[model samples]
Target: MTTYKESGVDIAAGEEAVKKIKNDVKKTFNKNVLLDIGGFGGAFNFPVNEYKKPILVSSVDGVGTKLKIAFLSNVHDTIGQCLVNHCTNDILVLGAKPLFFLDYFATDQLKTDVFQSVVKGLTKACIENDCALIGGETAEMPGFYKKDEYDISGTVVGVLDKKNLLSNRQVQKGDILIGLESTGLHTNGYSLARNVLLNKFKIDDYIEDLGCTVAESLLAIHKSYLQPLLPIINNENLHALSHVTGGGIIANTLRVIDKKNEIFIDWDSWERPPIFKLIQDIGNVPEYDMRESMNLGIGMIMIVDSNNLSFFENHLNSVNQSYKIIGNIK
Candidate 1:
């Protein structure tokens, strides 16, 4: 008779991993989370009476190839934050506030400490955004994943009043495009980035241009615009929002605009961040590829009525948020 452990599934280790992370995960709960970890299902109370017409907006996303940087750098913590924040921004573009989040973590071997660190990152972001980490699944499969490597994906659920739902219909001609600066290459373009950078430089190599090591630049946490944009999200002058992710600035911004209207982006509006320039010069990457793949410095785009330009600019300035008038809807 073959034991489960003999088959490479250590039930005891799995139990131990859950025990370590139990308390950390609980920190993200508010009054709404009904059940805790290790349950058949996590239950969250929906505050139905909070809105006149509540709309449930949900998005599921993974960290993508950016995880490769985490694996190479031996940093497991920030990757979880990347997944949570990425999902938060996805629903945020629709003008929703996160209610709860669920994560899926899978690995070939169970490393209790690494697992705990990842959950800590998740709980940190969830707490920051007032989102609950209701539940998640952790799997240990011996032959499935590569050695000492894991993958994570998360699903975020948020709510918005129907009246606050932002759509392309709200975007109009003469709408000004305001771009929020990105921290770095936030959770996208790693396939090309790694190919170019890693070939010529070690992960820890310091470059004067970047002012940091390759690991530092590549593993920068993805920014969550929730707190910064929440104040003006419902304003009448704020027409639409685009979260720059897998698609670069142009494609992602175009996603939230009307098909009948086209966006004019001044490519020279903002200087490309150093990490991007390094990738281009070393690899001799074409400008079109750079524009198509990376955020190229701008992370979030807001299309606001030109008449209210001063209002939007003032609000952002008051909050100490930097922005650029990259273009307008034509």
Candidate 2:
């Protein structure tokens, strides 16, 4: 007979971690979560009455090498938030309202306290978005990861009315492209960042330009666009939306554009954040590669009717949110 412990995966430790996080996760629960945490599968009680034709939207994502920054800084908490928000925003671009989230954590060893901190971040994000923490998996695989290293991924389920679903098919020529400013790197291009910065300067070394340690700048939490986009999603003038991620602004924005219409971005329209400038200056990374690899400063892009441009600008300004008219479709 094969034993789980002999296979290098400790079922007992995984169980203990679950037991520790069950109550804390429950704090993010809403009426939609019908099942408890330890079940064979998660159960979410969909609000059938809430929609005439409810369509479920789901997305899964990982923190990528941003996890390395978390491990290096000994800050495991916010990575969970990053995972949840990233997944949530992925579906939000389709005009979905998040319902619940599930997470998967895998590591070579189990550290209960560190895992708890990660769960706390997830819980906090779920509460802020009014979503539930339904269920998740915690795996301990001794050979699969380094002793102190772990990775986190999450799945978010959301709802949209069949009539309200947003797709790239709606994108058209003459639509205006608006960009929401990012709060630093927002969880991509870390491998390149680490390769350049770690070779030249220690994490503790303060740069006068950045006014802080390089590690602090690299570890900034990925910002969520849900709050700012929510108010305008129902507006018919909104043509298409894109959430800038690993492929940077061009690739991500193009994903939601119809092939017939080309997107023209004015590179000089927005201010590039200092962290990106630091990486570019030190690494001598080319401008084209920089545009293809990192967000540069814009984390999300909205494709809206030119007629609605003023309305969008007013709403963003009312929230004290900074944005730029990066380009338009032609």
Candidate 3:
């Protein structure tokens, strides 16, 4: 008898995986989540009364090829955090606070321990961002994925007061750009990074320049800018915000600025993080590709009026957040 397990899909293992993650997933819930995990769809009771005019903002993102590093290093927990944080930062640039998150995790075969670890990371980040993990889907497809490999993607739905909505229309010339430091690559450019670095090094290999193992540097959790910027998002001087992701600085930052104004970046204003440097030198990757592909160092850019430079700088310092005055609008 060719059973489901023999054919590669394990119904039993899937059930076991769900059993392991149930409690941890519940920890991310708030009063807003009206439905449980096994339901057909997640039920969120939107807090329509919170804002005079409440707007729902949502974004979906995955960790990309960075998962290859997780597979190689046998570290799975941080990948979940990276996914949630990346999505959080996406909507955050537009001045939204996450309300709930739903995840899609798919694998060839479900391993209970790995499943548990991934959910634990997810719940941890959801709690940290004051978001609820109301529901998620775990698919076990035996032939679809390679051995021991899985892919994760998440959708974050958030709320913003219509009065506080931010956009390029608010940006103007002479806006100074303040760049916030990144933890690492932060879920981008891994395709180029791996193609270049892996030829010369293994995941566990420690490099002096990176000051850590290859996996350690690459798997650094994508930082969430919500905490620091949330308190000051509506400030008059803070004209616009940009989350630097797949397209690097120019592509991402430009999206949040006025078309009439052009951004001028002082490349030398800040030091390039070491991991980026290693990738460039080792891969002989061109300067243009580096700038277009990776964050290099800065992960978020704040466009604000020059008059309030001191105010912004002092505020960041108070929070112990490092920043660089990288450029201005022309």
Ranking by TM-score: 1, 3, 2
Across 95-160, the per-residue lDDT of candidate 3 in tens digits comes to: 899999999999998888888888888999999899999888999898899999999999999988
Superior candidate under lDDT, 2 versus 3: 3
The ten-residue window of minimal lDDT in model 1 covers: 163-172
Model 1 CA deviation exceeding 4 Å by range: none
lDDT of each: 0.91, 0.88, 0.91
The sequence of per-residue lDDT tens digits that candidate 1 reaches over residues 114-209 is 899899999999998999999999999999999889999999999999999987347899999999998899989999999999999999999899
lDDT of 3: 0.91
lDDT of 2 by residue, 1-330 (tens): 988788787778888888999888999988778888999888988899989988999999998898887787787888888888888889989999899999998889888899999999999889888889998888887888997899889999999888778883388889999999988888788888888888899877888899888878887778888888888787888888899998889899888987787989999998899999999999999998788889999999999999879999999999877899999999
**Candidate 2 vs. true structure, TM-score:** 0.95
Candidate 1 is scored at a TM of: 0.98
Model 3 ranges off by over 4 Å: none
Measured with C-alpha atoms, the lDDT of residue 48 in candidate 1 is 92
Regions of candidate 2 where Cα sits further than 4 Å from its true position: 1-8
